[model samples]
Every structure is written in structure tokens, then in C-alpha cells.
Target chain A: MKPFDRLTTSACALPLASIDTDQLIPARFMKRSRADGYGQFLLHDMRFDETGAPRPDFPLNADAAKRAEVLVTRRNFGAGSSREAAVYALVDFGFRCVIAPSFGDIFASNAVNNGLLPAKVSEADAEEILGLIETTGAAVTVDLHDCLIRFGNRNYSFTIDPIWQTKLLNGWDDLDLTLSLSGDIGRFEQRDQAERPWARLPDRPD
Target chain B: MTATRQPQTLFDKVWDAHVVTRREDGAELLFIDRHLVHEGSFHAFNKLKEKRAKVRRPDLTIGVADHYVPTRTRALSEVAPDIAGMIRQLDDNCRANAIRMFGFDDPRQGIVHVIGPEQGLTLPGLTMVCGDSHTSTHGAFGALAFGIGASEVAHVLLTQTLWQKRPKRMRITVDGATAPGITAKDIALSIIARIGADGAQGHAIEYAGSAIRALTMEGRLTLCNLSIESGARCGMIAPDETTFAYVRGRPLAPAGDVLDGAIAAWRELTSDADAAFDRAVLLDGKDIAPTVTWGISPEDALPIGASVPDPAAMDDASRASHVREALDYMGLAPGQALDTIRIDRVFIGSCTNSRIEDLRAAASVLAGRTARVPGLVSPGSHLVKQQAEQEGLDRIFIAAGLDWVGPGCSMCVGMNGDLVPSGERCASTTNRNFKGRQGPGARTHLMSPAMVAAAAIAGHLTDVRPLLRSAS
Candidate 1:
């Protein structure tokens, strides 16, 4: 994962709200191994008809939006199941950042862990940015360090939790963070061994 | 003199109790009290096997083969290879890890969420995690429970702790009494409809007020089960005597003095009277009708008698466009009555609304009536099924021409070959109504079990209030 400073890329606008996880990557596609990329199955039902033909009118299938790196949508994006495949689909399909008014709690957490920034802006700002994209076909610039989005001479700042910003900027693995707290964790284990005996590790009976 | 102020909430107490340590960035290493596993556990188990890391607390973990196991009693040879292999992998992994498992053939086997509470494994004031989102169902026991990703699942397996940031607290108060024909499912749907999918984002909701207090244990579970669908990771209800009595004497519950001591601690888990929430939302219980979803999103629900929303009448541009898209996908007209829509099938099973009480509601509506369309009824657990049979509810369902099958998350996810065909519409008791959620090109209308049973008999959406009135 590269350290995200700033990037300007072509944007694709999906103006819908409450884009759920099941719609991002349906459960039928979740059975396979994660190593197998989920790019082709991104929005499989919405992107294609029942007979496996692409719906040309879908924004992602449109010729102008083919190589988009930034995906913009409305509030509560990724609102349903907690399938990480939803993030896999977006990232694997070359989407680096999702700009929304808000995000599903688990989905936002997963995005940060995978180095995908879930940028939160006001609903009015989101609508304005999306409007610019539709009218001018202009690309947007996302500056992580400055916490701002640039579109056609206007700058819209976004907010992200500081801890998540740190994790995303450094691309730090969560397990590594947990390992860094080993001293405190070990102390807690010792205290808990006496305080809550039933929660002890059953494998090591000692 | 110094003044003291602490806005104590139930979530605050449970969260503060489990912090192993806090980081400067406001993140904390929270200890897990219990872990539930199902077929989705295969991914985490594979990671564990690859790293050769054994489960840290095998006794604290419970495994079951749900999600992909077929509800129909068919030979293994007849099952799809991928589904069968997934179940086999779970069996082998649980055996090698020394984790207790309720396999597909075991009499105790059921949906992970259902069996946990029934077996007294989901106790009060505990932090629980599972790989599936509906794990919030266990929060009905006054616990802080939510879902985790595969990576987090593996982390919990290697070490019984997870790194998490504390979420804001929100209290959803439902005052006044509910009218007749209304159930817990209706209250949940009404709340979601009132508060859009993003209404509770970044908050853990604590359900309170008189209406919530009057609900049974099963009703509380049903309410919490859909918390995830509303964009909140968890929902909880404070434990009382109703909760205590249901948990006592269960197979895994503590005995005698230990039980007495545990109950005393749970009694103190409620929020203080002066506790201020980060945000609060209120609903009148009497205002909520038998609700139903006419669109792809759970938040797209409305009262049973309401007509499909006309996008032209909506003042908000975004909402209007959304309603239009939903109408196109659901094959509905703007002014059409929800109760006039026809359905091709019915399904009554899921982590949400598959308990014994849910079954009884459906049975009461189908006692002497016959199903006008094909439908299936899968119990949440083997215990629920046995109890339903003992009460002769199974006979009523079978007599009504509905398929009474074994326990699993059968048609809810449509992964086990129990799917509605393409272009067909179904009245489902599941939590989600995402496009093609039941199957490719299949349409789903979300409703309560009683409403679903009524639709199954009428071959179209019909208000259950009339049926309830007649039954009484």
C-alpha cells in the first residue's frame, strides 16, 4: 500500500444512496478464495443482466467512466452486510477513494484497513461535486494530507478520524498495532487470569 | 466542592469493562468474551491453519455449520460440492482446534445466532464477535456484540482481543403501547423507516422506554437482529427478569450462587437516569403499523396500507431519483397499493424472526387455511423445531401445504440452493431486500412472519390486522 499524499484522477458519479454490501458483491461470489480477484464481480447484478450481458447504460460500463479511479456516491454507502468483499470489489476494480456524505461503520473501517480512504464531506458539498462531474466531465483531486477535495477552482474539505487517517497514511497492518501493545496486553492477561478466570485460554490449561 | 458528571450508558459500561489497553489515538485493545462461528469461519480457519496458530480460547468459541448446509434432508452426494466441502472444512477445523462444534447432522445444529442464546452461551455484559453481521442478535442479552471481518476473526482466534475505537451512543426510545396485530418486527421496521439507513451511523443504539420493556426475549432478539441493516453495528436491550429467567438452567449457564452473583452484576448494567447520549431518536409505539418494505433497501419501508411512493411527489431530488429506481427494480407503480402486489413464493426463516415465537405467529394465521402459493418454513434451531413440533405447530404448517424443513439459514441468503427463481417475487422474513438478494432477477418484499404467512395464503400482499382480528 502506497502512502497517500494527493492524487488527481477521473471521477465516476453514482448518485444513489444506501449502496449496500450485497449489491457491491453478491453472496454467491463470496464462496471463492480471496486471492481470486473480485473485480469482475463488482456489482454483478447491477452491472449485467440476468443472462450475463453488460448493461451499457450503467455508469461503470459507460465509455467515459471506464478508467475512473475515484468513485463518488451519496450517504450510507456500503450499508448492509459486513462482507470485506465489498471493499475488495471496489479496490480491485481500480477505485482508490470513495467520496460520500457518510459511510457504513464496518465498511469504513474495512476501507481504512485496506488503504482505501472513505472521505466524508457534507451532503451539499457532495452534491455540488457530483454536479460538476456530470456537467463538465472534470476530474477531482483528493489531498489526504490537507484533507481537501479540489474540483474546478472550488475546494471542499473532508473529515476523517485521526487514528484512521494515521493508519491509512502509513498503510499499517492492524495486527502490527496489536503487537505493539504486547506489554499492556500481557499485563491485562495476568490481571484477567485472576479477575475473570473463566475467560482464560482453554488450549493451554496451565 | 467539585462537581462530578458522567453520562453513563449501557454501551459505555460494557465497553469500558473490556478495554485491555488504550492507545493515544483513541483506539483500544478490547477483549472478546465469546466468539461465534459458522461456515463463514472457513476463511479465518484457513488463515489460522496457514499460520499454525491455535485458537486462544477454544472453550469460549462455538462453531456450527449454517449458511450453506441444505435445509432439506438430502444425501451428501446430492449436495453441491462447494457447499458440502465448506461444511466438511468447518467440521475438521473445529476438531483440530478443539473448539466445540454443532455439525450439520447434530441435533443441536442451528443458525449460529439462534443456538447461542438458546444454549445459554450468549450471556449478559459480555463482548461477542462473529464473522457475520447479524451477530448483533446476541446483543438482546444486554451484551456488546457485533460482527467482524475475516482478518479480525483470525486475529480473535490467535488472540482473544480486537483493536477497536469506541463508538458514539444513541438511545432510541419507543413510548406508548403498540396496537393489536403489531409485533417486534413491525417496531424495528418502523424505526428503520423513520431513521434512514444512515440515521444511526457510527452509533450503538440502546433500545429503551416502556414499549421495549413490554417485549419478550424473542421480540428483543428480533429487534436487535436488524440493527446491522440500519447501518449500526450493534443494538442492545438492558437485561431484566424476563432475560434472567430465560437464561437460567440452560445447558451452559452458571449454577446456584454463581448464577445469583452474575445476575446481580447484570442488574447494574443499565444507563444512569441522567446519562446523556451523543444523540437520541424517539418513536411512538402506537404510531407504528404492521410495516413492509416495497423497495430494495430496508429503509424503503412504509406502513402496510400506504401506497408506493411517487417519485414526482418527492421534494428532495436525491430521494425522488432513489424512489424512481426502486420502483423500476421492484416492478411497482407509483400509486399502487402495497397490499395489492402479488407474490410467487414465501420464506419464513433467518437469524431474524425464525425463533419459536415467530413460528407460532405464522402457525396461528395458517391453522385452518391452505397456502395459495409455494412456501418454505425453516426453524432457527433444532430446539425451536422440536418445541414447535411438541406444540403441534408443525402439523398445522404441514397441513397448510407449507414445507416444514430442518434448521439452517436456508432461503435467507439463497446460498444453499433454496432460492426464488428469476423474475419471481417473494414475501420473505429475512432482514435484507437488496436487489437479487434471494436470487438472480428475483424480487423480495420484506415482512413479518405472520404477514408472510398471510401472503402465502392469499397469493398477494394482505394486511395481517384483519386476520388477527378474525382469529381473536
Candidate 2:
């Protein structure tokens, strides 16, 4: 792993409420295999012009925002269907953390499970951090140890669920969780099968 | 601790009763009754094969190959390479096991959810599971359905069971007749706008009332399909005559006595007039406008003539943050009128609104009119594609210069080899408008299928009510 990493990138703020998964990574890009390069397609609809030129009007085209590692998004940041492609795009694009006031339930989990830090801060804090980053090219530092985030000279406060916090901190997904309990699970299965013969997998006696 | 249950809501009753075992940490083990599998579930099948496990109920398990099957052709041997592989895997997996499968060549071939309802495989008072999220669409017919992962799919295939924590129940009621041009998509979007997407988080939403019941089965399906967008496990409407009528005469639907008993049981599945919910939200049909999702998420939506919500106007931290970022990504300034925005292409299809009704709605708009911009109309399933041909809807689409392609979830996520080219802005019917939902660098503006057609004709975000009025 990258250690208990702390990254402070200029915040590229998108000030629209409710960003759906499509805008993160459109469906056309989802055709290619995960290894075939989808990150380059991120925001294709908005970032490029008819001739595929970078839309100068796009915030992503702004030189300062181009290198941003922190994506400051609007409320309901990951709404709509639970497409993991959205997370894949963001993660692959070098966006290590996303700061939004609110996030979609499934999207938040999807992001967290993919090792992206999805933080919920107050709108004021979110705006302030965004403002600081955009105006001053300020950096935001995420400290997993204290469950806190810092932007510029000020410390921003937010709450992430402890369970998800632990998961993100440890980069553990459901399979990891199950595997961690393999010992107890194995014992439980053995004893249960011995006592109740019908519960074992495959249902065929060895 | 029984809370005087009198005519409890299906959402409430089903939720509470499903709690098999509760852990102190707020998760629970839920009992699953029916498991729905699809083409994508071949991975799960392979995983189970590695373990050499057998599916629990060959009957309870149902598989379909909607994702990879091409709607244009019946010959499976000649499909696109990527899609053909998935089709072959699904067939091989389903045949090797005793599970029932709806193969691509079957007359019932279509999207798993579409076929599930069409074949009457979806019924009231049953908990259904699938490997895809929109499993909630079955809830439109009063079934409790949710999505699971590949591993979970394997677990269900092996054991015919899954673990789930019971969610709180919420009821959203719509009263009165809808104004012309206002569709189920508009209603669902309006509710999301009011609740901020996460309003129904951790809750199972039961859609009830006159407007919900008045909808066609397809309309109800589109409505229930977006429940996950609102962060709910499912959205449901009680099984009424409308539900039964749609299920009748299907290949696998229960017949005669079986159907009669099923209907009788469904009659008792509704929430009594006295039923209450953890949360109740009421909307008048007249208040709903021709809605379209303006930003990335489904919740980030507005009526046809409405202006984008000004981020500066929001007081809530989360709401404000979303407004700003979504606007920035959308390239739409705050308070900008959504109708004024120009569009380069229009897409009409996907799981959300790719049924026959959706096609008809688009065809009605595109009839005798050439789209000012590039346009595409993709159906949800092969059956829908065939039904449209029988009704000549495909002719109208083709005459209008819109690509009339086969079914198979085309352009929804670009999984089946259909995609919107990068760097293009599209008015689309499929759910989500994330940065590149249509393709890498593709910008999507989520809207109803009719709206997509309207956008195609005008070459921008245009209102459909006037077009509808003119059509008549």
C-alpha cells in the first residue's frame, strides 16, 4: 500500500448538485476492459468539443485544476444506478479523495471500497475548502489516523462512519472481510455439518 | 412487541418479516425466496463450479443472457466477439446445472428484468434477488427485489439464500391524474428532486396511490426501476388488475388455479387504507413537470422549463457541495435554463426507459420528422424490439433518421459494444449523466425517452409537451 498517505492537491470544484454516475464515466467507455483505458474518457461529454477538442469552457481544462487530486463535488455526489464504472474512472484518474456534502448511498460504499476517500463535510466547509483550493491553488491533506481533513491553514471537520472508515483505512472489501473470518467460518461450517447434515455446500457426501 | 399490525404496508410488513437474525451492529441475515440470475452471472457460475457446489433450487433459480445477446440477430454463433462469449458462457453454465434459463433465442429472450415480469416469474409476496441493481423494478408489481454482487450471486446459486439487513420503510403517495406529457419518469424525478436522492436512504420505498395505480405496467416498471437512484432497496406498487393483466398469457406464468391462487394471495399483499409508514411523502400529479436530469445524478434533475438550481441558494452543506460540482462538470452555470442548452445527439434506450412504451413515445415524436442532430433508439430487450417491429414503431424511427437497433442494453453502459463517441453531449433516456456515462469523455444529459426524441428534433434541450400537443 501507499502507506498512511496524506495527499494535498488543488481542489477542482464542480459546483453542481447531484452528479450521476454517467458524467463520471459514460457507458461508451465501459465497453473496453478495465485494463484497456477508461480514465481518458472521463467527462468526455463535457470536456471535449464537437471536434474532440478540449472545451475551453470546461473547468477540467483549466491549467491549475488539471493536476487536482481532490475532487470537490456537489450534493448527492453519486446518485442514480450503482454502476462501479464511476468509481473506476475517478480512481483511475488519480483522484484519491472526493469531498462532497452528501453522496449516494451505494456510490459512497462503491467509492470507499475502491480505496477512494469519500468525505462528507458541511456545505460551508466544502465551499470554503473549494474556494481556497480554486482561488489560491491550495492543498487539502487527508489524515486517516485522526479521521480528519485539512485544507490550507484551517482544519475542516467531518464525520465518516467508523465501519467504512475502518474498511477504507484497511482497504478491506467484503471478500476480505469474509476471508478474515475464514477460521471461525470454517469451524462453524464443520460443526454445523456434523450436527445438521443438510447444511453443507454441494449437498453430496464425500 | 407486536405493533398492532392492521393492514400494514407491503414495504413495512415485508421488511419487518424478513429480519431472520439481527446483529448488534445493525446488519441482519435476510431470508431470500427467489434468486434471479443473468448473463453477467456467468462469473458467479464459474466460481461455484470451482467449488463444485450445486444450485439450491433449480426452479427458484432463473438465468437470462440479456447483456451480451444481440437483439438484431437470433443466430448466436455470429454475435460480436465480446458479447458472443458471454452468451456462450451463460448457455454452458445454465445447461450444466439444473437451473431454468431464458436463452437468447427463446421467444421470451430479453433483459432479465423485462422477461422476469413478462413471464410472470415476478409475483407478489416474494423476495427476489438478481446480480443487477435494477432488480427493484420487479417491486412495481409488489415483489421485494434487490441487487447483489457476483459473489452474492454465487452464494444464492449455491444456497438459494442471502444475508440482508432489514431496512426501514417509507411510503411515497401520488394522488390525482397526471397532466398530459407528465410520465412516470417525471414523477420519479420530481420525488427525487424533493427528497435530494438520499431521502429514502436505508429505507424500502413503497409507491402507492391513484397515480401509481393508473400507470401502465411498463410505466410502473420504469418508475420502480429507479428506486436505487433514490437510495432505496426497492420501489413497489401492490399487485392490482393492471399487474395481473400484464402477466397473463405469458409462457411461464402460472395458469388457471395456480394463477387464481396467486391473485388471491396478491390481493392480501397490499397496504390497507389504514397502513402507515416510517415516512410519508405526498405529491400531486399536476405539480410534476416534464422532467429531465440536468446534472450527473438522477436526483440532480429539473422540469423541462426549469432553471438549474443555484448552488448559491443552498443552505445545506451537502446540497450546496453537490450543486457546485455538478454544475461545474455539466458546464452549466447556476440558474441557467436547462431548455436553452444545446445538444449534439439524442439517445433513447437503456434499462430505465427502453421498453415498447418508451419506443412508442419516441416514435410518436420522431414520426415524419428528421432529427436535427444524430439520434439512436435502442430497446431494452429483443422482445421489445420485435414487438416494436410488429407495430411499425421501428419504421417510424428509421424514417426519422434515428438508428433503429436491436435490444441488449445498448448504450446504457457501453457493455454490449454500443457507445456514444467521446466528447459529445447527448440527451439520453438511460439513467446517469456522469462525466462519461455514454463513452469515455461522453457527456450525458439524462431525460425521458420522449424528451430525447424532442432534443433530437430541436438539436437541443427542448420541451416535449408542445410537440405532443402538435402531434395530436
Candidate 3:
């Protein structure tokens, strides 16, 4: 995964609420391998009609949004499904960051692990950013180091888990950080075996 | 002087007991008691292969072939190659890891969430993780269960632990008694409708009050299965007699004196009287009616007697536009009566409502009555199928012209060959009402099994109460 320290790029506005994972990348497209790029299938249903014709009215299809690396949407973005393929679609489609008032819990975690920033700003800040991006096709800078987003002379501080921020800045996945605590994990397991024997399942033959 | 003991919510007790280590950054390493995986876990297994890693605790992990397995037949030769390959991958991965798996021919094989509890793999005060979102269904047993992504699945496979931040607690109390027709599905829909889609965002909800306590273990599972639809981290109920009775005598559950000891420990898995929650919501169970989703989001629900909501009547511009978009996708008119809307088919299966109790509820409604439209009845598990058959439920469904098939998340996910036709609307017992969740361009109206059966008889969305009244 690529390190996500800072990115200044053209941004697009979806201006919708509760954009779920099924909408992000429909379930039908999930059968394909990730190695086969999911870029074409990102928002597949919304991007195209039943006949597979691209809907010109969609914001992402507009000329200004064609090269956008940032997406500004409303709250509960990527709301349903725990499919990591949703984040894979976003990253594969060249989106480095998604700015929303809030995000689905699992989606946020998947985003960070894939080096795609889930920048959570206040509702008002998200509305402001969406308006600016939709109206002016603004160039937004998402700075992970400062935990801030800047566009149109306005700076909005975003909220992210501190550990996630650190991981994003360092390009480190959870396994990288977790493996460092191997000793502590082992000690806890031994103690837990004594304290909560019922919690542990007996070993079964394969 | 002794330090005062802090009163803890049921979620707190379960979560705190599993914490292996806590970081200053607010992340805690939680030891996963049970890890359930389905065919979709191939991605995680692939990641493991790439890293040359082995599952840390094979004993704690179990696999099942459900998502991509064919429900019509267990024969791989008759299944689509891609779908067959997916099921094969899970079987091979489990074998490589020395993990127990309920594969295609296994009688215990079912939807991951359904069989977890059925096989007694899900228990009280445990931390369970799965690759599917509906994994929260296991929280019905007072367990701290939630879904994880592929990368997180691989993390658990390698370390037998997960890193998570503690979520705030929300208590939803349903006080009054519900009417006969108001099933757990109705109560769940009412709660989601009351609180918008993101109402419980970032919180772990503990369901309490008389109505909740009265629900059977199957009903509790149905209720918790939809928790993710409301953006809740998880939904749980305090383990009680119902939970203990349900867990008893199951294959994987403790037996004899060990069972007695386990029950004693499980009995203590409840919120202290003085425990405080971050938020509290109160609802009258008597107010809950047979409900259905009229739009894409699960929150776009209403009682059967109500009409579709007009976006123009909404105060918030964002919410209004969302409603408008949903209405457009669903092909629904603003003022149209929900009961008058016609459905092309009906489905009585899913992790949410495919247990024996759910099947019996649907079968009772469908008995001696022919369905007006085509439908399918896939049980939650093969065992459930056998039980339903023994009860003559399969004969009733077949007599009514609705196909009775094997179980494996058939039409609920449409991962297998079973899919609702494009542009067709289906009255279903599945949890999601999202666009194309049943299939591409397929519209889903989520409701209870009884409600779905009623719709199959009426060929549209109709109130199930009157049907139940007449049936009785």
C-alpha cells in the first residue's frame, strides 16, 4: 500500500447521504479478481444505466470530475457491507481521499488499511467543502501530517483515529504494528487461559 | 482504602474480558474467541499465502461454504465453475490451515451467521469476528460480535486477535407488549425507521425492556442481524434463560458439568443495575406494526398501513434528496399506499429470518393457501431444512407453488444462480433493501417471513395481521 502523507488534487462532490458499499461497488462485480482493476466498476449502477450507457448527468462523469482524486460526500458514506472491495474500487479508481461528515465504522477501517484516507470533518465543514467543490471544481489538499484539509482558502481540521493517522503517515498496516507486540500478546494469552478457561475452545482434529 | 468497582454494561464486561493489550492511542488488541469464515474469506487466505503465514490458532477458527455454494444441488459438477471454485477455495484453505470446516456436503453447512449459533459456536461473553457484516447476529447471545474486512480477517488469522476502539453504549428499551402479528422483524424495522440509518453510528446497542426479554433466541438473532443496517457497531441482548436453553444440547456447546459451569458464568453476563449508558432510547412495543421497507435504505420503512413518504415534505434538503433518489430507484410514488404496491416474487430466507421459528411462522401463514405469485423458501441450514420438512412445512410451501430448496444464502445475496430478475420487485425476508442487493436492478422490500408469505398470497405488499387472523 502506498503511504498517504499529503495529496493536493482536483475533487468532486457526490452530495449524497448514506452512500452504501453496495452502491460503491455493486455485489455483482465482486466475483472478479481484484487484480482485474475495479476502476470501471466503481459506482457501477449509478455511473451507468441498465443498458450500460454512462449517465452523463452523474457528477463523477462530468469533465471536471474525470481526474478527481478526492471525493466529498455527506454522512454515512460507505454505510453497508463489510466488503473491502468497496475501498478497493475507490483506490483502483484513483481516489486517494474521501471527505464525509461521518463514515461507516468498517468502511473507515478498510479505507485506512488500503491507504485511502477517510477524512471525517464536521457536517458544516463537509457541506462547505461539497458546495465549493461542486461549484468551482476546487483543488483540495488533504494533509495527513497536520490532520487537516485545505480548499478555497478554508482549512478544516478532520478527525481520524490517532493510530490510523500514524499508520497512514508511515504506510504501515495493522499487521506491521501488531507484530511488534508479539511478546505482550503471548503473555496475555497465557494469563487468559488461566482466568477464562471456558473462553478457549479445545483443539479439534483436522 | 479500596477502589470502588465501576458498574459495567454487558458490552463492557464482554469487551474488557477479551482485551489483550491497550495502546495509548485508544486502540485495544482484543483476543477473538471465535473466528467464523465463509467462502468470501478466500481473499484473506490469499493474503496469508502471500505472506507465508499460518493461522495462529486453528482451533479457534472455523470455515463454512455458504456465500457461493449452489443451493439447488451440492454437486460441484452442476454448479457454475466460478461459484464452484469459490467454495472449493474455502475447503482447501481450511484444510491447509487445519481448521474445521462445514463444507458443501456437510449437513451443518449454512449461512455463516446462521450456522454459527446453530452449531453452538456462538456463545455468551465471547468475542466473535467474521468477514460478513451480518456477523453481528451472534451478539444475540450476549457476545461481543462484529464484522471485519478481509485485511482484518487476515490479521486475526495470523495473530488470533483484533485491534478495535471501544464504542459507546446505547440502550434501546421496548417496554410494552407487541401484538400477535408484530414479529421481531417488525420491531427491528420500527427501531430503524425511528432512528435514521446512521442513528446508532459508532455505538454498541444493548436491547433491554420487557419486549426484548420476551423474544425467543431466534427472534433475538433476527433483531441483532439487522443492527448493521442502522450503522451500529453491534447490537446485543443480555443472555437469559432463553439464550441458555437455546445453547444447551447443541453440538459445539459445552456438555455435562462443564455446561453447568458455563451456564453459571453466562448468567452473570448482564448489565449491572447501576450501569450507565451513553444514550438511551425508549419505544412502546405495542406501537410496532407489521413493517416493510419501501425504498433502498432500510430506514425508508413504514407500517403496512402507511403510504410512501414524499421527499418534498422532508425538512432537511439532504434527507429530502436522499428520499427522492431512493424513491426513483425503487420506482415508488410519494403518496402511493404501500399495501397496494405489487411484487413480482417473494423470498423466505436469509441469515436474518431463515431459522426454524421463522420458517414455521411463514408456513403457518401459507398453509392451505396457494401463492398468487412465484416464490422460494430456502431454510437457514440443511438441518433447518430437515426440521422444516419433518414439520410438513416443505409440503405446504410446495403445495402453495413456492419452491422449497436447500439453504446457503440463496436469493438473499444472489451469489449463487438464484437471483431476482432485473426490474422486478421482491418481498423478501433478507435484511438489506439496498439497490441491486438481490440482483442487478432488482428491488427488494425487506419484511418478516410471515409478511413475505402474506405478500406471496396477495401478490403485493399486504398487511400480515389480517392473514394471520384468518389463518388462526
Per-candidate interface C-alpha RMSD?
2.6, 6.8, 1.5
* Root-mean-square deviation (CA) per prediction: 2.2, 6.3, 1.5
What digit string (tens of lDDT, one per residue) describes model 3 on residues B1-472? 2458898899999999888898888899999999998888888998899999999888989998888888788689998888888888888999999999999989888888889899889999999999888888999999999999999999999999998989899999999899988899999999999987788888999999999999999999999998988889699999999999998888888778777888898888999999999999999999998999999889999999999999899888888888898889899999999999999999999999999999999999999999999999999999999999999999999999999999988898898979999999999999888888889889999999999999999999999889888987
In the range B10-68, model 2's lDDT, one tens digit per residue, is 77555554444444556544546568777667657766777777775666677787766
Greater TM-score among 1 and 2 belongs to: 1
Candidate order (DockQ): 3, 1, 2
Candidate 1, A28-143: lDDT as tens digits: 88887777888889988889987899998888898766688899999889888878889889989988899999998888887886788999999999999899988998978998
lDDT of 3 by residue, A1-206 (tens): 78988999999899888889988988767777678888888999889988999999998788877689999999889988999999999999889999999899899989998999999999899888888876777789999989899997889999987888988888977897788888888898899877667676655643
Better-scoring candidate (lDDT), 1 or 3: 3
Rank list by TM-score:
3, 1, 2
Better of 1 and 3 by TM-score: 3
Stretches of candidate 3 above 4 Å error? A202-206, B1-3
Q: Which regions of candidate 1 fall more than 4 Å away from where they truly are? A: A63-66, A196-206, B1-7
- Residue B284 miss distance in model 2 (angstroms): 1.4
Best by DockQ: 3
**DockQ of each candidate's interface versus the true one?**
0.54, 0.20, 0.67
